[model samples]
Target: MAEFESPIVMPKLITFLSSLLQRAAESNDINQSHQSQKISVFHGLSRPSISIQSYLERIFKYASCSPSCYIVAYVYLDRFTQRQPALPINSFNVHRLLITSVMIAAKFMDDLYYNNACYAQVGGISTTEMNFLEVDFLFGLGFNLNVTPTTFYKYCSYLERGMMMLQPQINMSESSLYMGISSKLHLSFNEDESSQSHHQQQQLAV
Candidate 1:
């Protein structure tokens, strides 16, 4: 029997994961190709139409699986990448990978998950494709699905670090925008003062 895990920690990890997947989906091929050069099969796959963020949010909104499912799915993804360097997550196949990883995770972590056909509908892929992807993904990871509590929290801490790194970039962008607005406001204030001075001069002359 699979170990029961808590879902409480999943939300924060999901947020971190959503950001990471979005960045990965939007990344160019140069770096990804270099990383997964050995996985030539991925090069032939077509990119999904939806953005990773939108797709993940859709899953979160509609999927019946608990939050821990996503956290476990993230672990599977990391392990898969480590085990299969050639098949690293890239834009071309990221959507399929996300769907497969989460579905497998749900099956492993939550005993009451929907089957591949149901997941297929959620993923916008056919049942056959879903099954194929599941098999391929499992083989890719060598079926390493069991995550201990300690390992789970360790993964959580890694994601927390990633979130911290990302937050600063966001803050910096917001700070720059605030400064731009401040500069514009200051210029507007200077113009207002100049206009008032001109009016005062006119009043004095009159």
Candidate 2:
């Protein structure tokens, strides 16, 4: 059975971030080419660091988890990266890593148990791949599982309340406005000042 890991220590996190930044700078100079090259650059730099953050953001956007849970997940990912220097940080692998980390973290903080099959389906990886990665991830994290963040429940509750408050204002059937908000939340495209102003005008009309 998989177990929950302890929260990552601080000094290790700092070291990991430092290394990640250095790698990101090096990746920026490399010319983009094939998928492998892109993966190499991301693994060496951006994806490792950003994946945790992005994953946390995505989970919080949908789940009622606290920012603290996300923070703990970030810390775990960072520490694990520091210790497992060989782990890939490319787009594909980074996503896999993030999913694995979050699953472990949820168990630690929320007392939730996530199955490999769910992770495989969402991550588009085979169950064998997920199992392999999970083992590698567990080893990287030092088997110190015992994380219990204080904020996840509270944040989730707050989000629920906020959504409830907004429900009356949102017409679920209206695709355009719903799409606009969703786009903004996902940072899919840039919204300039004029766009923001226009959105405000539209809101006032409603």
Q: Which prediction has the highest TM-score against the true structure?
A: 1
Show where candidate 2 strays beyond 4 Å.
1-67, 147-206
**lDDT comparing candidate 1 with the true structure:** 0.60
The TM-score measured for candidate 2 stands at 0.43
Q: For model 1, which pairs clash?
A: none
Model 1 stretches with alpha carbons more than 4 Å out: 1-13, 25-28, 32-45, 161-206
lDDT of 2: 0.42
Q: What digit string (tens of lDDT, one per residue) describes model 1 on residues 41-71?
A: 3333577777777888778766788666665
Error of 2 at 23 (Å): 9.1
TM-score of each: 0.67, 0.43
| lDDT per residue (tens digit) for residues 1-206 in model 2 | 00111132222222333344344334533423422332321132333445434443454434443223443454455556455544424343555666676666655555454577766665555888778777777887797454322122222233233333444453222222222222212112223322322222221111
- Clash count per candidate: 0, 10
